[model samples]
Target: MHKNFTHILTSLVVVIAITSCDIGDNKDVNPASSFLKIYDSHQFDHAIGPVDVVQTDTEGYLLLGNYRRDDTNFLGTYIASVDSRGEFIRNTYVQGSNVHPVGKFLLLGGQRYFVSMDAVGLQGYLNQVDDSARVVSTIALGVTYPMYAENDGTDQFILLSYNSVDATTVLSLVSADGSIANQSAFGIGAGQSVEEPIIDHFTRTGRELPFFAGRASSGLYYLNGFYNYTLSLLFSDLSDNNPTGVVQGQQDEGGVSGLLSLDGGQFAVSRFNFGDSYTNALATLNASGTTSSNDIQSNPMLEWEVDAKVKMISLTLDGVGYVVIGTTTKNQQIVLHFYDQTTGNYVAVDYLGFSSPYQLGAIEVTADNGLAILGSIQVAGKFQRLCLFKVSEGELLDLVQ
Candidate 1:
């Protein structure tokens, strides 16, 4: 989950089409568009990309990402606040290592905290910048292995870390005061890189039926490993480590492409299949841990072949979820997949085909309903154009739907 800086304001125009495929008849009549641009930091020598964005309790936006200089390995992780209009108000770069932040920002109490996956491992920090970007309190908990963290709102936070000794992965719940409330380990085989662990509170509270949602692994590296089918979900009390039970099992050896949890039983999960050379299904799960009535979203096929090596797939959310598919196609084109969860089939929605030679640098969603897509498009003879887009509902849909 990377966050992109740099904001652009572009007016949106609406239009309608007369297609015979009233097929679903579930789609909204009118769709809107918003264009956004990626944060350009080369001017300052530090390339800044949007990692992840979360809406703060203060009605402001928190943008989390890292900045690095091409001349040095100086990676800087930061958290900044912006208004609803996407105006930068304050910026805070985390203290210590110059590493990148790899995950989403979790809302803890009146404050917000997120996990910073750096050159070393994963470290936890806050976004409240006093003077500069400093951690109010930081901790290096869990195995040095890849880990995931989430906020539960009940004073207890949750984490999933891969354990080498046990040849298994453990899920733990930490209290608000920072204590290991509970923990449990599950064996997903070994030698697998389990990066994204999604946690949801979806069972007990009726409102909390499907609690945890994320990707796991069976350690099938190479083509199979990149399949993006190793997805799972825990639908129990997030305050507890084991969370009572899991609502779903590891389906495809697929990766947990993207995750989004909404109120009620509304949540979205994206699954990608690189081995097959295309972005597959985007499923919507209900509060009951079951796929929603319109569970599967299968639309807009994204199959691009660049320099020959197919680009990996990544997921993000602004006000909505976006599925970005990158490819080694000759032009280095990165395909953008957008879906309108309100009335989508849970598959790939609309797609925008942007061609560049810089290779997709960073892809993230903004809290202000914008998309921060960073990469270089060949310009003149050099790939120097930092692309940005403020993506909105029905906009991306218009392209492929």
Candidate 2:
């Protein structure tokens, strides 16, 4: 089913009263120049949670999310396209046998596609759609759950799946037409691991590589890079591989949540620690995989004793720093933290949302250097609805009132 979703009327008024307060170096930044514009806030009849948002080739926006018709059953996946002004263009529900959509949107061969697993997670598929929101084709992928698809610069893509039955990691190189060109698997033995791989694209050298960062059974964080299409382990922390410095926390209770590429063959990673208290940390690594710097923060308001979670994170296009978004349990507000890479300073900390029960989905940088935060908001003490808004960097710095 499909419908023209509209922004919540009460949210428009709530946003105007919610302003960002500056807490860092703000001499040159203008808080007044910062503005929060609501492109659109949509409330779907069914419960929907956004996963990712990407700018279309035609300068529009496409939002991919999971939807549920009932509390117990998975309705399928939700796809929505909006214009530059956040006006609703069209939306459709791609029914699946699985409980959720576990994939990302890919733009390949000058076409748009939403690739994901079915409800049962045993099979994956790609929905090829036109600009007018019409599905032209649906390509099936014979894979299991915990799989992800990433573009390889060319029209082809790389699919990575973890086989729990055999304790193996499978890599498949898929062509643009949904055919698997090559497939391979690597065994990691019997261990509990968190697998979140990221594809890094370097603009200067036009090079791309995929790296998987997670916590192995050895109780240490490991980052492994793969050879293009071959699924060969280029480098890892294993005994045979040229292992770099292993990331060890006070307790082996945290795992990598996000990864960002930095200048000069360096990268930054975020980890969430759930020990006696909740903590979110950032670390930097050199090209050789050596940890250069590690900064950990636990519960910003220590006295309040509130729990804070790092829900999502993304680096700025210029690689200046990162924007960390999460929720504070006591205050029930979405917190934004701006980290300055060079100085190793948290330049700013701001808050959004007015009440508790606000869930954060994802964060993406806009074309004009602004930020688009995707999540859901509970209205009138009822159900949760999808909420999206853009905030300028200046606004985050408290330069604009």
Candidate 3:
């Protein structure tokens, strides 16, 4: 026991020495390969207009966003590629009325693709791109107004769209050729309407509609959106045109804020109501879908008010799994809470960009096992630009589990 204690103390000293010697330029608790970069054109009135970012197959980074102009005057599509060191490599801006980038890139059959809503047809389109950030081909989806696109846990895409005619959420299983294999319209009621959020996104009104959809491990498809005159998580069989189960919530004041799939048929979910943030660190899914009686969050990890956005992501570090809840709080900063996968207990909280305002876009795991967060920043205290915060793999492992 004496020898083991001495060896452990020596290892701790070594870790402290390395961290103190080599940290990010920010002077925060950084580790090797850690970086914080604000990526954009760097020209006046120029923004990268990032929506989502992904680590490319070449071990670099690719960001998908709007071409130019702000939310109101979108010119076309924008693709910015950065090297592994977070340095700018190339920027591709394609201005066209027929292309408007949506959803993050999905890796299908070893190829990366993303969905877009064409400005002309106003219909969802699947665009395949090469490694050089060039669009190889663009195909149109049968569904109109594709709000969110996700992989179906198989080889196809599960498009969560909206029908402008009836203001209902449309679920579709689409092929690579933009073919709809199976589709069903849901969440229709006498007074429920999704027309407001749909128009808000296209018009860049700045209003938000937190929508999420994907296939769970139980082979049931789940969608969190407005359904049955209230915000709910609608579960379906998809074989038939009816809902198999529905986890209902308050009409508009409360609902599922965010959801992320986990191993063993579990999910890490976040909830909010009247600006109060809550989270269920882990929940199981079944045929009827998961639900709660009193509060969706049994033990809240996020103490701040989540007024803007809530996102959850899971990562396995050194053979241990963890769930991280990220929020755009009312404090005008990005807050991330990491939790243990086995115990579902709160681990640590990281408050990013307290000096400047930051908004959450998407959270992803880097190729190096680090944490890559993509968001927008106010550059020079004025211009809205894309920013990335990469927490080194060592720093993250030191925090959770």
Cand. 3 Cα-lDDT: 0.70
Candidate 3 clashing pairs, residues 3+ apart or interchain: none
Worst lDDT window (10 residues) for model 1? 8-17
* TM-score between model 1 and native: 0.53
- Candidate 2 achieves a global lDDT of 0.49
Candidate 3: misplaced stretches above 4 Å? 1-32, 46-49, 67-76, 191-194, 285-295, 300-306
TM-score of 3: 0.85
lDDT of 2 by residue, 183-292 (tens): 65555434342222211111112121222433322333233332221222222333342344434332223333344444443334444444233323343343344331
Write down the worst ten-residue block by lDDT for model 2. 199-208
lDDT of 3 by residue, 1-401 (tens): 65554455445434433443332444654332676666645344554455778888776778777655544343367777777766678777765655557765777777778887777668887888777788788887887777788876446888888787776788888877778888878855654243554466555654465777888867778887767666677788787657787766666566777888776778887776655667788875444654532245455434565546677788888998788888776666777888888878788888776455678777889878887788877644555667677778887876763
Expressed as tens digits, the lDDT of each residue in 296-327 for candidate 1 is: 44343335431122222333343444344433
Please give the CA lDDT of all the candidate structures.
Answer: 0.40, 0.49, 0.70
Best by lDDT: 3
Error in Å for residue 277 of model 1: 5.9
Residue 218 lDDT in candidate 2: 34
